[model samples]
Target: MSDNNEYQGRIVVITGASSGFGRGTALELAKRGASVVLAARSPEALTELAQECETAGGRAMAVPTDVSDRNAVAALTDKAVARFGRIDVWINGAGVAAVGRFDQVPLEDHEQVIRTDLLGVTYGSHHAMSHFRARGKGTLINIASALGKIPTPLYASYVASKFGVVGLGDALRQELGEEKITDIRVCTVMPMAHETEFFEHAGNYTGKKAVPIPPTYDPKTTIDELVRLVVEPEDEVITGWQGGPFSFLHRLMPKAIEKLMAGNTNAVQMGESMPAPKTSGIIHQPSKA
Candidate 1:
């Protein structure tokens, strides 16, 4: 249960609402009395999630959307406004990844990860900012990863996309400050590896079962931070207990941190994991699982 009055009268739009942090956040906000607009590639999943949100005691709208498509993202915004009047918050939580040695993963997989993760955030941020500018207030939350600050092996494209997200958030904040837009906030959330369907959906060519790095925290930890951000927006937030220290270490010793992370990923994702056949996962299409 949540404090129903905390988010009363608020409307939030969440991409990748079918699963992972996006879904968890939506449900939590809904329980707190926020109207949630859900967007994801799978219509069925979105529909189901919408029902769950409503059942949890808040309004919900399911919009089948591919965030990679600018037009689809625009339409998602339009639809949310049509039903809810305006969006108080927009969360760009949609992302995808391909895990393997950079060259071994298909060029198409790498391109798709960029298109969905990086470009999708760009599209969502563009529309959210436009709306915020019109209303003179709103919060844009971009869900980046710890990898954005400390690059690691086995996730080249994901790292690149998350780095872009972090940079994008920083630039947006700078522009807002320069323009004296005090009410509009741009926040980036960087969370360490956590238990989520993200790994299940990632394209894997590592010849080993894809698993989250060790010391993975529960998804709830990251979800709680996201919910808190909606109430108290910050320029940047690093969730998970390990995220802060790891990022700090990287800042102090970039080369050593990088080498250590590469070895850690290899040990956990390759050496410790079971053998598996290569599969494209969900990079090119929606997951059927």
Candidate 2:
């Protein structure tokens, strides 16, 4: 449990708030008395989530946004600030994945994944940092994946995007430190495969069902970690029981860890899952699911 007082009067802007970690974190923050500004591609879903957040005992606003578009993201920031005066924390959690061999997946799919996952974070960070600098203090959290640290075979584009996110966070921290910006904080979260709508919404060309890698943890664990970050922002955090150990092993023995990850991805995401036809998934559009 968290100290509810910690979040009292705080304002948070969360992208991808329609589902998964973003939704869960919003509810948790709402319970803790933080105002939440929800952004997602689905207006209906965002409206419903906003109502739920208010019901959870916090202020709420819904802003339908597609983070990939720079203009849209800019408008989202403007709307959040307009609604809440200023944002105390900003979470860039919007992302998409395309699953298949690098060559097999459509070129457009790969581009879309990069645009949504990596570029989306970039845009959010840019706007958030600008606001934080002017406000004199704020926290920016980027949701990355364990694949950012350790490469897997199937999710090539996703791994690339996450790696970019990790690097981007590091660069931002370095810049902030050089500028003597002590109050503004940048944190990147890396988590192993968890139970979320991610798998179901992933574009698949592998002719097999999209499923999480083995040892998928519960979404609550990731949500708890996100909430913790809000209270005590750190530079980089690896969530889940397996995340730390795997990251450590990868650093110590890159080749061996890569081999193991490849085998695991093959066994679970490819071999173990049922056959399914190719689908564009939510990469091209919002999922009706």
Candidate 3:
């Protein structure tokens, strides 16, 4: 059976298409017969993904793009539209996360994440809306995180960015409804670190590093569920139990939730310096020490 209804021949644009869930979801959508638009800053990775999609008997294209650039994003939309004549779906998967304590984290750290995670969605969805307004149908999918709802310790910037995404998606859903734009759907995909390469590149505070929780808790096993929802349709989905508690406890008991997470210095790591993500966002590379 097809994983999509009315998705055959549809054009789907995915940002951060080089690795992780972006890459995985792009290929899977191709397998489902959706024409995929693979996007990212890394040309080599996207080029390889394109070839793989083709080898799978699916039509695909690798467009090297930095979603933080409005011009680049518009070009991305233009290319997708030029290739397929219209866009059926837009997925903003490009994001960066920093794991560290609040004080140790630099203010400049999150600008990149906000650009790619929050503003990238703004650009993609804005462009998608213009296209959908003309065509009368389309969907905007932003890959948020479970922390979008519950703020996390180590990933303050990441959580803030994702929280913006969740708020953006929810608000846009309302804005589109008010405008009578019934065909456009705005949603978010919330997932933890799957088996993707993001972990290696995940930015962290110089203050500390934390132990690995469970790899199974990551994306590989749960990614299918995320892809399934984007293919089908949904409001918002909580993917795992690591995520389940926050929503439940936060709602039923906010004070208790904060108390539980209070002063949990688990994520703080003291150090000289660590690697910052280069291929992910538009932030300047940290000075080489």
Candidate 4:
């Protein structure tokens, strides 16, 4: 049994809590005794997850929020603070991706990816950092993807957004230290593809064919990693042993990695022919709300 007593009286805000990792993480954290604030654009889904949290003997609030809007995100932070005295952990799990050759994809999709993935994380971090600063302590967990480290074809925009997330988180850590805000920590959780509607809902700018990865995750794995991020916020956390190796190879041999990326099927559009999302760089965005 894991000890969830640490968050007994804390508050956690999770974006994109409707489905995928966000929903999983919300349930996991709530079970750990944290009062969770669930934010997602889909009111019904968010409410359902909130109900699950409540039934699990955990305190939770459902806030209908769209991460793409800065104001809405700020309002969520305000509401969280109003309900709970302080914000302990703010998770930016909302993200969107598109699968297509760059030339075949639309620029709107690139914009959408940027707005939802990069902008959403930034908004969450900005709002939460303020709250943490006021309280003098907290953790900001940004849900990123393995693609951030190992980019693959057909997801240039997605890769670009995640890279921005990783870079921003790193810089924020340094800046926080410089500012003497030692208690406020920053972490980025990078997970490989999990069983979710991520691909189905992902923006498909490329009219060329798009396919779905066969489902294969237990969903509990996401819960496990998310629990870790809350209980022990580290500089970065990466799941999926396979993806971990890809990260290593990418850094150890840039040229080899590049060649491998061009020829590899990691980011290939999943089809009925594909087994699952296991080997792909596609990951569930926690904040694609």
Question: For model 1, how does the per-residue alpha-carbon lDDT over 1-289 read when each residue is reduced to its tens digit?
Answer: 3355768878999998999999999999988888999999999999999999999998999999999899999999999999999999999998999999999999999999999999999999999999999999999999999988988888999999999999999999999999989999999999998999988888999999899987898999989888877868999999888788888888899999899999999999989998889998988888785
Report clash pairs, candidate 2. none
Error of 1 at 71 (Å): 0.9
Top candidate (TM-score): 2
TM-score of each: 0.98, 0.98, 0.85, 0.88
**C-alpha displacement of 154 in model 4, angstroms?**
0.6
161-206 in candidate 3: lDDT tens per residue?
8888899889988888788877678777777545565655656544
Candidate 4 Cα misplacement greater than 4 A, ranges: 205-218, 266-289
**What total of clashing residue pairs does each candidate reach?**
0, 0, 8, 7
Put down candidate 2 lDDT per residue, 112-207, tens digits, no spaces.
999999999999999999999998999999999988899898799999999999999999999999999989999999988899999899999999
lDDT of each: 0.92, 0.92, 0.72, 0.78
lDDT of model 3, residue 21? 83
Better of 3 and 4 by TM-score: 4
Report lDDT (Cα) of residue 40, candidate 2. Answer: 92
TM-score-better candidate, 2 vs 4: 2
